[model samples]
Target: MSTYRLSNQGLEIAEQARQAKRWKRQDEKLARAALVSVATLKRFWGQQPIRADSFEHVCRALGLEDWQRLVEVEEERSLDFPQFAWDEFWVGREKLVVQLSERLQNSCRVLMLAGMTGIGKTALAEKLVLELQPLPNFSRINLDHREKTVEFSAIATQLLETWKQQISDSDRRDPQRLLNWLVSYLQQTPCFLLIDSLENVLRGSEQTGWSEFIDPLWVQFFQKLLAVETSASTVLLTSQDSPAQLVELGQRYGHLYQCCVLDGLTPEEQMSLFRQIGLLVEDPVVCDYLSRIGCAYEGHPLALRVIAGEISQAPFDGDVQAYWKRYGDEIERVKQLQQTAEIEGPHDALKLAQYSRNLRQRVRQRIDRTLRRLTEEVPLAYVVLCFGAVYRRPVPERFWLRSLEGRSLDENQQLAVLDALYDRYLAEQVVMDGDLMIRQHNLIRSIALDHLKNLQP
Candidate 1:
């Protein structure tokens, strides 16, 4: 779909017409008459692109007869979006898709999807973007593949160079100017922006505290985006943990910013996904077995996908019974332990056992990256996570905080470390018996317990 803005002459004529009709910038009555948002009204006055229909709405609202004469069709800016291949039949998250779609269209300015690795945040985001009826101009950046020293300035430079076509050398050299220009440009130009793996740009090592942006400018960029009340643009961020800084911004500007914590698929969703992957979930025994595996992994998409592929491939050939005979023990072990209390938990820390070699490798790689960052940057958080693995069920926050007792940390510092785990999504909060509780994912607990012995005193 095409987008249109106002030309210099059109802007002048529209302003005149609007003034004659007593319409003013951000006028609620004008917005209601046009059937558009206040942001859309601002976009109209600012000469930023809006949908052709919305442009017509504004023109009609102003009592302009020649809408075509007042329009300036914007030249489409081609963006290099990431290549994603999705299944023909998407499995689930029907409600999430609807919620995100509506939010992006009407209300949300900065929406973040935060979750553990392989939890399907990116996949769901991709699905939403792909299915957008009139896909707007969009761009994406993979923040994970970058050098540690690279700052937001470099990214700003590339964006300015790409969309704006030309920028002064001084602007490119000055981080503050570049940031200002970029923010201003986004405010006046409607575009969908996606930043993946935001954690990579964060100060996530033991040397640096977790969840703060490594580059201070990044913090400023988000702050500006959230503070702005008039914007036609939307930003989507996918991160393993919601940065504490961004979370604070969301708290302050709750109307403009939102964070969704992605979790595992539901049981029905899990079964649908398995069936789509050509697994024989029709058999009652096989269906029950697959559900057990789903329970074990908490229906983690990537892990479930890998296991399904393994079950469908050569040696097993869609035979769940055969696959279960081999890997069922490992899955059952987790299910059993997860249901047990701390008293009945495993005596020996569960050693790594292969369910599917591919599943283990992928889950481990993703988990290792987070753990390594914790171990390097916030060792206290890492220690806390290791200690947290001892709990089979969700426990009070005090338990995790108390683990750091007798250490050098003060109450504030101790709370900060525990929050670090929460921010990283290594620990999850649950409600039990009307009280809030916390626990780690089964896969995370298994790995953490094995390494708890290795942690220093």
Candidate 2:
């Protein structure tokens, strides 16, 4: 019984040791992962070296149960970005500004905003900085211009210059010391820091050199800025892609707010935007049709603007179908040119070379594969479906199937083929009259018909 009791105690001791070791490992990892040197970390932690107990104490103080949770919280905080006004170009994302303003007023540490290109992410960021300009403590650093390559040192220098210009400069030359002093100052009097167009900085790094992309100096600067406990200040960042590194920095320093992904406009918003653009559409039928097609185009503001421009220039002549057909052809042509440029390379010389080599190759492969899959040779039903697509109207499946009596397909088989086409993105499915209406985009339809005509003897 005594031996059993001794074994149990040993087991408990071993488990406790294991837990302690795990905690120590995590603490070391977090310290190393931070974008700062030992000295900086020591300074941030009040000149105390991070031992196992001290690390645990720090974790406990931050209310983090584990290192992973701490990391996650940090990442989440860094991804938060303030909403700006200029983001009205895209659909469905104005609420972000209100949320950001609330957070800013509450003195959130970091906000990161992520969105795709042409989504007006930059414009929103700019507007946020403009709004924050009235505050004496507000300062902004816009890293948008492609020509400018900003490093940590450069950014630090800019911050110092901005500080000196706005306030005063007692000590200016030493970046490290200046940054330290700035952090101490910010802790006392909070300020807003805006980092705009991080994509340009990341891309520039890839083009120039990875070493140049995220300089150690910048990392240290961020680390220092983050370490400062400022109740009044918030850092806002805007990027096209995920700012993983920035998030990491935020984790090491302070709380990272939620990330907002700005999307395109709603149907109502698109209509409002059209009205703002000064497009006149008095007829209810035409307006409804325009709204339907506009919504169908995924509420992309730029596409709506393009459609609006086309409509304004060429007023509809009492036939909605004719108007759509005319503009559709022009849009398809422009799309084709754009696609060709993208696929063949942006440079004219390279594009010509690529186009010459791979002309009709993909289309031919698709045709050959499709032909092999069909049980009979070139069915008339398929031909009619393809031909109707050229009209840019949803053709009823039953009408086309009945039109080809001799080449009639099993209903299930016909549905399967349609599904296959849709899956391949070669066709689009729309609902009309409570029936599944399959139609191809004008570009795809034009290409398909051209291929069919060429196949004729």
Candidate 3:
């Protein structure tokens, strides 16, 4: 059996042209036969300019329809991965998929997927398309590729070949007309269309660009699609952010679903991901420490991956303190870079010495200011907090608030200080295990501690 196939109409036309016995003019009849043969070849393969005479002679000797049909069937089939593959990809966003599917299933001509960076929203959208890939008329357009520009006319051209329609010159050029033809094609054929990274088209520019041309064109095209009396066609769009105008239109028409916010993985999911990524830890102590850091960082997949990559290359006998020291050095280098341009002084032999002394004094004063806020007496609490931050884990509030004897703080004073910190946006209170937990962002904590460590009386 041949792997590709032509439509029955195409096959019949080719057969009749081949079997034509009465040649009123032999040359004209031969030319028509050659034209039919070329059409068949172009239909099976894509548009290619080749000698029609040779193709016609071959088709006359063999019935190529079955071979063509089989080839087409095989070409349309999707591939399945090996069963033993690692499958590091995400799974089980059924709720979000169903929500999107329902919106696509409803009156909305388009559905948009929006989420934060690195949340796996694109994976979910691709998964949905994979689910729908078996459908005959389904097609996808990836807008992320620089070489491709998606216009209604281009979409219609791809659809024409996929649907095996007779390409009329008029149908190929008119976007509005082509869109109507596409809607009709989709209605009868039940096609699923996916437009990925649609944020590209939605981005506006100060100069004339795609946002000026494609945006309004797609808007009108979608409006026309919605107005059409169709039941089966669906268009799914994936973007980083929701298109404001489209969202407004969807709201007015009550066709949009509530946007789903994809968040970082849960602790259990993060563990599973780590295992999949080939990080196997048998030591309970090390595992517990890494897990604490992971939880503190909100189980953000990228951050966990970075930490895992660092640990995987570090010496097996290396301690957590060594890792902290290495990371602290890197942080100090970054701090110096950040402060370089902010430093200023005069240039004279005596003045230069005085300027250097003044700069050192100012640095000490900054350190003192940071330490004073953390504690009045020892001023070492800031140093401990900074060292703790290098581990990328939240320090327990009691660790910072403990007295010289290491006793827990009185509730009233603790609450007052916490309230002040919250007001100043220095620390945020997170709820964990039914208790108020205090934590600061990693960068701020780093700066606070770096200053405290440099402080001298």
Candidate 4:
């Protein structure tokens, strides 16, 4: 059941009503009058979530006629946005939301959420746009429309024509003029633009090695946006790969551009997600079992959600142990191996595998597409990833480089390949024993190990 608290104005009105009724201000007295526990009374007064029934009783106790009137209203969104399951699936990233919100409001002009597929970049971007609603103008273009591929020039022309009705036909026909009109209009009119699946518009095939814009007009548009001394608008992009031009522009205009790389959910966050989805996490044994699954997946959001759904359904019926009883063998073995690796060293750690073959199709397919792209475009980076997966725990940068010593790459080329792995969010950085090290997620390592096997000796 959903819970709610009093609105700010409602709280003030409730206080006045209480005083008019000549009620004692003591918490004990109020709790007795409201017929709720002191904890519930306190929760009501503190503006924390309380049951609707409890809230109504408290409101009646204060002589307020309408309890519904006192409850906070839902936030109103002014702009038209595609609907998403924000309340259901969105969890964690609280700090990230605050950080990005501040940057977008104050300093940052163009922001990008860059990460691997299924990493929730699009979800987070949608969340940001929703939270910042009621703006004067808002527009979004999803580049993932395979049925009708969207072009940069088309996007710019549409925005210009819609926002500036008086735009000359000649300007809309000319790419440079169309971009200039859009940029100039944006500089004056404060707006929020969200572009999703930007990689669809990028040159990411085997020939291009990822990141270059398919349409040169996009490069010019972004350059002009960031190069401008000031702009009244901001744009947010979600992409599987970071745009090379944006990276270079970020170097030149550091203050105006920001790129946030997303990773998997934390263990604590994963537990919250499991509980939210009706999994039995209250039991310590069950909690521990789920935690191990999280470790096995390395807190991958999609994988954890899939596993949680399985446990919450049918014969399992939210019985984590029962789910474990069937699927726990591999998790148990991985747990033991991880413990041994901490002492025996990473080499002793067995190569981790993906989710059991039967259950991993969705996450597997998603990750497979990304890995296939990497394998085709930047084989050197892909090779580094395969070699680096031999370590079960985070290792130093030198070790990743050391694995490539036999290859033809020089120092600079090797470093670039390592950077490429990081840029694509394939390699993760962690601090262990007060020293920073590199590691790969279990799922990625599983696939990488498979690729490593196919490499010619």
User: Candidate 3 on 379-419: residue-level lDDT in tens?
Assistant: 33334444333323344666445422233545664444444
For TM-score, the strongest prediction is 1
Ranking by lDDT: 1, 4, 3, 2
TM-score of each: 0.78, 0.46, 0.47, 0.74
Off by over 4 Å in 2: 1-94, 127-133, 165-174, 203-213, 249-255, 281-283, 292-297, 302-325, 329-457
Cα lDDT of model 4 by residue, 11-115, tens digit: 888888878877654454455456554556666777777656668878987877677888876621122566442434467888999889989888898999988
Q: If both were scored by TM-score, which would come out higher, candidate 1 or candidate 4?
A: 1
Candidate 3 global lDDT: 0.47
Task: Look at candidate 4 and tell me the lDDT of residue 430.
Answer: 83
Compared with the true structure, the alpha-carbon lDDT of candidate 4 equals 0.74
lDDT (10s digit) by residue, model 2, range 64-119: 44533222222122112344334222334457666776776674666767654334
**Model 2 quality (TM-score):** 0.46
Q: Candidate 2 at 242: error in angstroms?
A: 1.7
Candidate 3 Cα errors over 4 Å, as ranges: 1-87, 91-109, 205-213, 255-258, 281-284, 289-457
